[model samples]
Target: MSLPHTPLERVTSIKRKLIILIGVAVGATIAVFYVGVKLGAWPGIAGALGGVVALAAVWFLARGLTRPVREMAHAANLITRGDFDVRVSAESRRDEIGALARAFNRMAVELGETDRLRRDLVANVSHELRTPITALQVHLENLVDGVESADPETLQTMLDQTIRLGRLVEQLLDLSRLEAGVVPLDIRSFDVETMLQGAVRESRLVRPGGAIAVRVDPTGLQGVGDAERLHQVIANLVENALRYSPTQSAVEVRATKTHEAVVLEVLDEGPGIAPGDAERVFERFYRSDAARSSEMGGAGLGLAIARWVVDLHGGSIRAEARDPQGCRIVVELPTAIGAA
Candidate 1:
């Protein structure tokens, strides 16, 4: 049943309001008892009737104070059943219950966001796997039905698809390990120039004709971190740049040392990321240009993995708009005090 509205509802502090209601109920009871005795009623009967009057007054006056707690209890039960959308209407009050209600709402919002990410993860992984699996299945079916010959060229194409599927699976496992904090970092000083050269060579092999340029300030700049993981970071950055960069346009990779940090950059001359998508581009499977990203066979996990690795090294990474056009991704890692 709904609480009967009382004048004490306007009070902000529940403690003070409850005290006042109790005082009023006691005063009403005493007044009623005195009136009955003045009318020549028996003292015992008058007191009993007065006690009933006090109980009724309390029931009417204090019900509103407990209503919010009841609402929260109901909301909590709903939340336990996976209903993150449930909300209590107690925040409109200026009481302790109101603060609790606001906190509950914030928790609900975070839970909803986490649930959304989980759902998206499953859906995106399925979609990414389906594309390559579908291609392989169609080719194999054609060959089996004698509709097409399994020539050297056809076999190579199927092999490439198989390799792509393997790469995706491997990356997924790598990312899982990275996220689980199980991948041990082998931190040490390494030559930034050598790392860039190796990454560039790999990129060249992947796209033979794409132009990739690298520059390390001071000619032999060094970084203090896990060399292998750092190499993975640069390789992913370079690969992303190569995939999006226009033909004949060079992807620039630069490494420079500051007073306390070693900064790495990759600039690509592709259609730049939208301003609204700058931060979100690092979220797993979140592609700003979904159609183009799918066409380029990007699973959108590279930057997310890079961010995790950089975060593990106590470093920071961000995206920026390059001059005139294009995008620049900057990764900054702290340098050891005395390391080169």
Candidate 2:
């Protein structure tokens, strides 16, 4: 592609044109004065002065148009040098060049955000993968050196660690697919009560001794969504609750109908999220201080995946502090009329 003219070149061209015009007018005026002096006419000098004034007006007009062009070129050069902070302030004009400058500024902002996210992704993924790998290596080394024998419990512990690693990998893959827009939702109408019941039953299996409650309104509430994906969303939330809450503490899964949507909440009697972590908790590989050090069998992508599934169904999910203590995760999906 051909490169466009730089602002400096444009300014130089305008200056050159002004000089040439001035020189031509002066030469013509000299020629006229010489002829007029020979012919005894005095008006030729006045005509030449008028030509000079007209040339000055043209020069000013050229400068007026090129000012923004120069500023835009400088901003472009800064951006080319990887300076995302460069901004063009000439957005007031309605011309094509003004629109181009606005678009360039917007692109720089997006590129900056993408770069930050890329750095965060690399750091978080490295940290997450390192933990499980390091644990597995230590255990294997102990067994090899006879520090710990291959007892049944020791074998089982190794098996659990390996399984945790597999699960983490699987979650990462799922999140990647979700983000890539390759996971299509299988939309259908399903009763919310049945879904919650299944999730609560499954959660009980995971935390056998934990006290859990499932509360749903008698009037059936229904919603349109991908049943499998929605089930995963609920299961992940409940599993998260069970993993964090103190053993024997009550975990509640409740569903209620609002005017336009059905709200399903998973509430746990655990230490609530820290003040600044409520939003970040849903990010992939993010963990609050209380859960970060624990050997929780998750890669911290559960909430992120849940949010994606809910968003696919045009719904919302958020974390809130429960009354007195603990955290409540609320999921809201639009209810289908006359569906049970």
168-232, model 2: which lDDT tens digit per residue?
A: 78888998898898987777788887887787777667666477788887557676777778888
Alpha-carbon runs more than 4 Å astray in model 2: 1-56, 64-82, 92-94, 145-147, 293-297, 336-340
Best by lDDT: 1
In terms of lDDT, model 1 sits at 0.84
Candidate 2 lDDT trough over 10 residues, lowest sum: 1-10
Residue 57 miss distance in model 1 (angstroms): 2.2
**Each model's number of backbone clashes?**
0, 0
lDDT for each of the candidates? 0.84, 0.77
RMSD (Å) per prediction: 3.7, 6.9
